[model samples]
Target: MSLANLSRIARAEGDPKVLQTGRSSLPTADRVARSLGWFSIALGLTELFAPGAIARTLGLDGRKGLVRAYGAREIGAGVVSLSTERSLGLWSRVAGDALDLATLAPALGRDNPKRRAAALAFTLVAGVALIDVVAAGSATAVHARAPNRRRNYRDRSGFPQGVAAARGAAAALRAHDDLATARRLPAGSEAKAPAVG
Candidate 1:
């Protein structure tokens, strides 16, 4: 089945009243994740640049351990940034990826000209990413309130049809109840006849 249909089913079954909430919950979560991911990158970079000093200060192997840990962090940050779906989330991802690139830059400058140049290039690209994500978040926000966001898509697959049917069933039930309530009501609200014995 199409992804849209699956989403509809999951939402309807999960929460029938899902449409009631507003869209004010996107920014904070993405920001927090971004901050943590960047911090991971910063720490990784520190370890890379002064693995021995850092390790000795903290009581661990400095160079090899630092490289391994920081490399792992960089890769992990890249994955998280890539996977996040929200535009704000994407920004966080960008920030994280940039942070990793910055960490790589100093290591490149240590000795090997090739590695140094590569790190510098990555740092530049990562800076661009920061700008990209900020714009993406704003773009998504504008897109959300464009007044016609829902009119673009027509082929809703099978799930929307199923939801329509379920809505039909529910509306029919409500109408029946309304009619029953009307029949059983007194004509005047002030006074009612005694129940028939």
Candidate 2:
């Protein structure tokens, strides 16, 4: 019923070759997530500080306010992605991209002189959104498959059993030292150590 026993059972049911030998120390997938997070933060900062430039580039000339609002959303998504698990954060980015494309749809009107620019921007956003979707799915799969092997009190390498293990090891070393010391004495010597009552 304990968590450790459950983990053991799960391991027993699975292929031995599939068992993870040790903890992940910076999984490549996680690193990709973090990189995306930094990218989000950078893009967010650019949008927030230069809404007018972004509006001009995307051919949303008079929609600086809308662009700035989107920037705020970007900043929020960036923070979430960087501070937590990648799945949620990347999904948020995907949602943000959808909103971005929706907002740009009007700029693609036939009468719009900057329609081509808007289309290019939309294409770029769509591509990024695809990446976000893939990354989110990957992150989700990684998270789900990852074992919950938290260092808990019951585990020997964890904190709870620390004192007991240390004490046992120390006692073993002390016994070995005492035997060695006794053997070093003269062959006929009767060493009488004092015992405190």
Candidate 3:
């Protein structure tokens, strides 16, 4: 099956909202990116509201402004992700995740009371970054492909749609062949005389 079909089936099975609303479907990777987008928004809200606390937790003594700046970046990424095409938004999130890791990396080695907490946060952020990379890659690939062609149930161009259609097409083709053969024979000759029962 095409990636689009697989994503549709997966979403239909997993998301109750899809069933209830009967809304248009999105690809699986796009769904993943949307989830990440929500996550970014939540995380940004936390950081923007509690920058001082987050800075302390990460072993930063007076970097509340930096934390808030990063929070703004997260919020921007989240907004872009939610509003834009999957590939671009997802890749932007990946970039934001990279920036987050870069900002947090120094705390891992610092001599501070929250060193362990910083380490744990670093690990969690790294794991999330991995997910962002994966979702970004999948979205990139899905977006790179051509749009899907809808299946035509009543396809009629002499191509088989089902067993019945196949049989009907084949019969029509055979009759056409018979007529062509008769037209090519001598006027007095019966084309099927040799094959008569």
TM-score of each: 0.31, 0.60, 0.61
lDDT of 2 at 45: 84
How accurate locally, in lDDT, is each candidate?
Answer: 0.53, 0.76, 0.76
**Candidates sorted on lDDT, descending:** 3, 2, 1
Candidates, ranked, TM-score: 3, 2, 1
Error of 1 at 163 (Å): 35
How much is the lDDT of residue 140 in candidate 1?
Answer: 60
Provide the global lDDT of candidate 2 against the true structure: 0.76
Candidate 3, 98: how far from true, in Å? 1.7
Number of the predicted model whose TM-score against the real structure is largest? 3
Residue 98 CA displacement from its true place in model 1, Å: 2.5
**lDDT at residue 145 of model 1 (Cα atoms):** 61
Tens-digit per-residue lDDT, 1-197, candidate 1: 55545578557466644445456654654554555456545655665666666434322333467555655665465345434644544555566566656655555554543564555556665765666566556546643666755674556645655765654433323332356765665545213433221
- What are the clashing pairs of model 2? none
Query: Which stretches of candidate 2 lie above 4 Å from their native place?
Result: 1-24, 145-197
Determine which window of 10 residues in candidate 1 has minimal summed lDDT: 188-197
